[model samples]
Target chain A: MNPSGLDKEIILNAAEEAIRRFGPSKTNITDIAKILKVSHAAIYRHYENKAVLLEAVTERWLSRVSRPLEPIMKENNDPEAKLRCYLKTLCQNKRSSVIEDPEMFENFAILTQNSKEALSTHVEQLFAQLEEIIRKGMETGVFETDDPREMAVTVFTATSRFHYPAFAKEWENPNIESLVNSVIDLILNGVKKRN
Target chain B: MNPSGLDKEIILNAAEEAIRRFGPSKTNITDIAKILKVSHAAIYRHYENKAVLLEAVTERWLSRVSRPLEPIMKENNDPEAKLRCYLKTLCQNKRSSVIEDPEMFENFAILTQNSKEALSTHVEQLFAQLEEIIRKGMETGVFETDDPREMAVTVFTATSRFHYPAFAKEWENPNIESLVNSVIDLILNGVKKRN
Candidate 1:
């Protein structure tokens, strides 16, 4: 990459780090530029403002995190297996993303307000993608849900909250795998005891 | 009530509102004093500092919210009923407390230190109160569970998150009640399909 391109990359990485440390509200362009050993004007050349830079960082973060799900979502034929994989992927990876990068998550929240249309568009796309997998499962008779959209919402909500216990103020047991399994089973098989 | 006692009540309410609006970091004693139409020095007479004022506000918030459960919890003879009532109480009441009172809950995060010790102390007290109900249900073979503590945590975490959709983002569904009921059912009965 050219020197300018390298500088931009460095600036973006430092911005992400700053967001992680000070949260979205506290992080500023000067802070990021200072950490990057570059002028604030140089950052402006690459990005319009702090908002734009934050949005780009959030986009990068989501793309990186969501990338792993694409393969399993595309290739997997078994709905149950796919659902299991999705939960496991979240349990093993997504949880760490929040715990490891709180600033990134907070930055994402702040950027969402700045660019509501863009944020909503991306959110709608994710929800649609999730709903498609759920609809497929319902069509295959692997899932017995009456409302796939609602079920999708419920499962996604429960799984997302599982990752961030700080916000929710509740946590599963240390046996995370079994906790994941039990929650997945509850969703898959409607929690009514079997004969 | 004595005039001094009434002034204390007024001060605490104002403090709670200030904390909720500005968050713990931004809220100051001057703001609370102004809101209560009292001298800033008067606040210092009752509480040493903002931190002390915040702790008192949080303790008051907890006591207010937890008070409603006391009757349902104390009166309930059955473990399953007690657990169900507890879950219902949390789902119905905890939402407003969290939503309307951000500082109160945020202060909880500070008090709890996001550790099992704080969590266990609260959960253990709740569990002990529900122990007889759970034990009686287990003895009668109504509830089939080996570890009530783990089950209590699971129920608490799931039900608590079920109500707070904004935090999770995935729970923006319209039919949240049904969704909550489904989770409750799954927990009460195991999720395996019945014959």
Candidate 2:
């Protein structure tokens, strides 16, 4: 035993770097141990297994993504603008993350590919944020009446092309901004109180 | 050279069956020849290369898909009905194709993955069909005014989740039909003429 004493934070960092370098399937706890200069047992103490470590890393990523949106969600701005900003920011965050480090993002994708429950939790958080804005709009007579939870899902699914990583290749197109704007307008017209 | 005389139709049939059995990458011209009881050179005589053969198979698949939609496009129904029917049929066609034999669909996906040009041609045909309906709607004042081509594209992109093969896993959800109906409601609201 090296007995050098490794923390979970340090192990998480090494795991992320290792995934970036080797892709998901090739990355392993043993590799992270090598990077951390500790025994595999030491790493295992912090993260019970590969799946556990992956979930932790994914949770960290989701929290980082959620941080910027909290202000937009809590702000007293018009619900329409808040909803628009929330979606635009969400799309931008995903697109930029994919573009900034494509290889790393690809590895992350493989790691999360089968973790349906983990990904679903992240989406549930998004739905909750959207539902809040939707509910407020419905209450203030600014938007049409509908189930806030359902409307939130419809809006999110409607703009899937812009925000979904599967469609990220299309994000680089010059017309993507207008496409997002057009979809937003379509959704607004759908949701707003129409006479 | 086993010049037993193979036609393009025969070769395409063999190639498609081969792809379905072995997937795209694992499938090769030699394997197709083995299936056909002929020399690879005999198969090559009809198609210049594997890329050419794959494109032929894709074109055939796309044309088969396009056949059912032609009647809906040509029908003199209201533009709104036409648009709704067109999009619904498109989504159903895709979902069924994915569901009926997922393995074949998966193999087809691999064959067509990198052939962006081939797939774009199919989408262009879909767009053209959609644009026609939108133009008719605009002329009759039944729908809101916009560039028909642009609006057609927007509608197609917005409804991508139901139709795109990437989300095939979600197709099994029992609520997918209702989700689709809600989206159609949203699109109609977005496009219909307002007072």
Candidate 3:
């Protein structure tokens, strides 16, 4: 609850914990309220109902991913280095989340299937950051592509083996990091301006 | 039945046709026999049962794809050009197969899920072809990679949107061909030696 007594974040945190432990299908508002030591009505004031709360939970989780990248996206670092770090950080975060809270992650994958609009927005938000980075590279003469939006999608697809959590089982492979680095090298070469 | 009458190919072709029309779940040996104009016992003599016949059908179908690529694999061409052609052909063949006969492709996908051994062998054969192409590229100092097998998987993952028929709906987009070519271009750049 962050010592604030009760706020949306507190309600969300409690809901997140409950969902993590019990799975989304079984978790209810009363359970979240029990964790918050408050009435379910209090949580309702913030999120409306179970479905809305779950949507909020997804939005919250996805925002954590986007929030950290915003600064990186706006950073003054070399475009290539920034892109490399951006992708590596995204993968590491998703991988650790999958490893530490696999049940929660699995529920999120299933939940997103029912929340396509939120999922699409989340995707667009991530792509916007990627497009920003690619556009910066083009402006600075570091990348050569004319279509930054398409290039961002290309980069996303190319790195799916690393950043996409569905392939988390493959992340346990000892060679995964090196292979990811090799793939990143290849992708970087693909986007870099040829002299 | 071929001119020789009631051979394995004839029975298998009948089975394939039956699967396509009725779908895998409803396909049966009797229907295949009906197509071949032979007694079910004649089909049974070649295949122990319906399951065995289905396995043979999958193997035969996969072989057709591999057979055509053998010469391209052995051809003395620029490694990059060979790879581009190889991947493009694979995608085109898969896309055409899906568009021309979606029912058969869907049945194959479902059937392959149950026939894991045959599916594993089919995957290995495709990976082997990919690895051979990567090895040739490395030998000619065209592509940059220390582990060709891992790189082959990476290539497969990168180009999956086009070659894997599961994404056939996405292939219907008017920009799909150019998008595929763009992705291919990115992948090619990723692999080429950085000298």
Candidate 4:
């Protein structure tokens, strides 16, 4: 019998929880199926194996988290505003309020390796979008950069500190907003103080 | 029979090679013994177990690599010069020229966790030394920072990108020196363009 739409969603949610608890290395299909109160075969019918199931879970999470960026990227007429919003979203999401689970972040390295084509496409799309914003900002004399792609990568990498596990304790401090703003200002205006 | 000094060194070297080749997860004592042309019991005499052998190997590697920093930290009077030199050394030694094995880099993460207390103490001492330099710079009105410890962490983290695997390919370019210099400049002088 074909699993219902709800069955797939339940299985995906169970898999996400299992992977988070055990990491990609230790997680198994049986563990996920048991968590869902379903048979392992039920999961195999919906998804081929644990790898594909984990991949689907990752794709689902990315879609959910990245959805808000679509409207911000599309509707904002000003490239600088769009870029600032994107950076803010990335930094601010470090807080508990914005992120429901921290474990979702761990799967990215494994997911990136296991599904290189899909992950690369998604990352390339993000870089391309950021590059477009940088190009527009340069044309408007808002951003000073000779190479937009390199600058985009630099910006992305700098902001990635928010997601790093090492920074989680520090991110809880009250001054996190100011710290994030300082980092953003350093990138946008350069760190050299204007005389 | 006790292994000779030469035999012990050979076993340790072979174990290092095996760990590098197979990674910590797959490496076995027998594999190391086979590589060294010795019985596995000889390795047990020297190391007690694989874990202890790995720890010794890691400690040996760190001691050899970190030896140069001692003289610079102790003899250098200028904090900035010491900091700059230390950072340059860190970036330069990302891959040990003497080892000629890329696998050593991958095996290091395993060793870092294997000897947490020793590694942590060593890192703490290094950070403390860096913090002193930062504090001295601030006192001399050469460095602009309210919190020397936080500033040290920021500098260390940002400069560490030079040693990251992701940046290894890009670092081979002739411009990497200038790129690292720019990052240092930004940390010390801020990034804003002067009028």
Candidate 5:
């Protein structure tokens, strides 16, 4: 197969599709190559190995979740609203991601557990989005926290039940939305400047 | 061996010791009986099967963690102090439990995952403790939450990273205490009445 017009993006999209279709455990470089109509060597030239390609696929999926939040952080001036939107979007995205293709999600969850580098990078990306909003909040005097980085982590940890994959099993619980809202209230109340 | 005087407590103690020594997968009723120097029938009389015995063992271990928190709820007059102590003790106890016997801890974690009744009962016990403190705080005007049950769940979810066994890998991070304290600060600020 011709290697012309084949790029990282094309390979990654195909890889994601392959994983989504066949699931991660059964996904192989050949499947991606076949999907891309390119030789395995072409994909190898870009990703070096199946693992690297899968990491890119995971990264791509993760970035899709973070990409929209960037504007919320950059464009929105209200820290409280920004924080709320960020958290709600994050929770919604994660829950939908799980709900859409639970089998693939579980496969990737297990895959990410074995790939700590990819896992940490994904976490750091989410943290960076939060830190940016928090830093802005502190700068604008809307929030009272001294360290936005620490506060961001605190928020992430505080809201893990809603967003974390381990707790996805409970997302179907009818009360999850109210639970998420309640926690958000508690967190917002926590970070807001004291009257 | 004679079955007289070999009560549930003795059998549970022996079962725990066997699990701690041989790990849950390998520990069996006969081993527990041998340790108790009683007939296997005696152990069987107390627990119908291995699953039941393991559940009882888990219940015993869980109770040990919760027993100390009971007085903190019932006897402590200051709700804030009680909340702080309950959280700290819970975190410390969970961390120590993991450290003391990681293998057995992992065993129990898996066991609890399979035993929904045991898991929910354990959760209810912890939530009950938090609810008591929150209710007291609300009554005394120290806390400003409308629903104490919701507040307790929020607190539990917020502090999960410190206490959840799945996050044990990150507990050794030197900054865990500071991170925990920062969260506690955020939560306290969240719950306390506005000045």
Candidate 6:
């Protein structure tokens, strides 16, 4: 997207790949440029600095976390089942990111520790997706709620331990899957309408 | 306790005071010894080193987090009210620890992040207290559950966002009290007996 005639995707891919292979501390703009066969200045045209570029990478990663659940939101399945799948997939996405590349994940955590603007946007996007699912459930007359957005926030915050980075270390417990399931069941039961 | 003419509690109190004043990095056994009017050698005679003393300080602090809830467990209030009081006190304990002394808390978090032996014991203590409340509720026929311990874990994990240090930044939201109440209602509704 910059004047170098290279797609922003290519530059991001190279940056991520370089960071993964070399780790964030050793990876620099020049290394990213080398991987993409473009001038570091070309990368600069898009990102004002390395910090901005890293934030973009973090933003992209955070944006993709809930992608697998998006299909569930649109599916013609029972909203309750859809809710379970949505939460499970959301938790899985976070767990797999930690398992697959812990170094890069830690790098992301450190780089964005003090600045949460990008993270706030990512969380809002997640909230909107969750809100849509709750709204659909309400429309189906299966959920009992006057405020889908508030219900969404309640459910999201409730299940945070299973997905949040702070509790990532607890994810490896043998009871983790069962724990998430129990919480999901409680949420579903709580939200179900009474005749 | 080790010919220092000082009780272990006195030493701990002095150590906590020194850490609060100088911060953790600047705090050392000699500083604590100075505070307690004991020789650095006398302090070493009781604690093997600064690390042991620091861990002990952390352990003592963790032990006290649930103290205020002890009376609620023995109260004759409705089980549901008891549950709410238990959770609220637990949360307030954590929140106050942050608000009253943000520096000390960050120090505690950093010191214990890698070594969770002390924290694991602390979490188990919390789980035990929660299990007691749920068991009483089940006995009163107010709660519906085949396994109180599991239910305890489920509810605790669900509401973790409101209490866990990772989401500490979000606790200041004006809606936090209402949000926590909403989640508590969802949990109570989910686990209440249908009869």
Please state every model's RMSD to the true fold in angstroms.
Answer: 6.2, 2.4, 4.6, 6.9, 2.6, 2.8
lDDT, residue A98, model 1: 54
Top-TM-score structure, candidate number: 2
CA deviation > 4 Å runs, candidate 6: A1-5, A21-28, A111-115, B1-4, B21-27, B48-51
Candidate 4: give its CA RMSD in angstroms.
Answer: 6.9
- List candidate 2 stretches off by more than 4 Å: A1-6, B1-6, B39-42
How does chain A of every candidate compare to the true chain A by TM-score?
0.74, 0.94, 0.89, 0.76, 0.88, 0.87
Task: Supply DockQ values for each candidate.
Answer: 0.29, 0.71, 0.38, 0.18, 0.70, 0.73
True contacts kept of each: 0.32, 0.59, 0.44, 0.22, 0.76, 0.78
Q: Where does candidate 4 clash, by residue pair? A: A190-B191, A190-B192, A191-B190, A191-B191, A191-B192, A192-B190, A192-B191, A192-B192
Per-residue alpha-carbon lDDT of candidate 3 for residues B1-195, written as tens digits (9 for 90 to 100): 442367887788888889978988799998998888778788888899989989988887777656667788888998899888888777777777777877777787677667878877977887888888889889999998878998887777777667554466666778877777887899888788876
Tens-digit lDDT string for candidate 6 (B23-52)? 777899878988877788878777888888
* Local accuracy of candidate 5 as per-residue lDDT tens digits, A76-139: 4588898998898888888888889888778677677767787788889888888888888788
Please give the CA lDDT of all the candidate structures: 0.63, 0.83, 0.79, 0.66, 0.83, 0.81
Determine which window of 10 residues in candidate 2 chain B has minimal summed lDDT: B1-10
- The candidates, ranked best first by lDDT, are 5, 2, 6, 3, 4, 1
- Candidate 4 residue A54 C-alpha distance from true site, Å: 7.3
lDDT of 6 by residue, A1-195 (tens): 334577777878888898888876677899888887778788888887887887888777777785777777778888888888988899888888888988777766655563488888877877888788888888899888878898888988889898778787878788888998899999988888766
Cα-based lDDT at residue A16, candidate 6: 89
On a 0 to 100 scale, what is the lDDT of residue A30 in model 5? 93
Q: How many Å off is the CA of B51 in candidate 3?
A: 5.0
Model 4 regions more than 4 Å off:
A1-58, A70-85, A91-109, A128-143, A164-193, B1-56, B68-88, B96-99, B132-142, B160-195
Instruction: List residue ranges in candidate 3 displaced over 4 A.
Output: A1-7, A10-44, A48-51, A67-77, A139-141, A165-175, B1-7, B10-44, B49-51, B64-77, B101-104, B131-150, B165-174, B193-195
DockQ of 1: 0.29
Tens-place lDDT per residue, model 5, B1-195, is 468787888888888889878878888988998888887788888899999988988888778778777777767469888888888888888888888878777877876777789889999988887988898888898898888988999899888788777777778888888888888888988999997
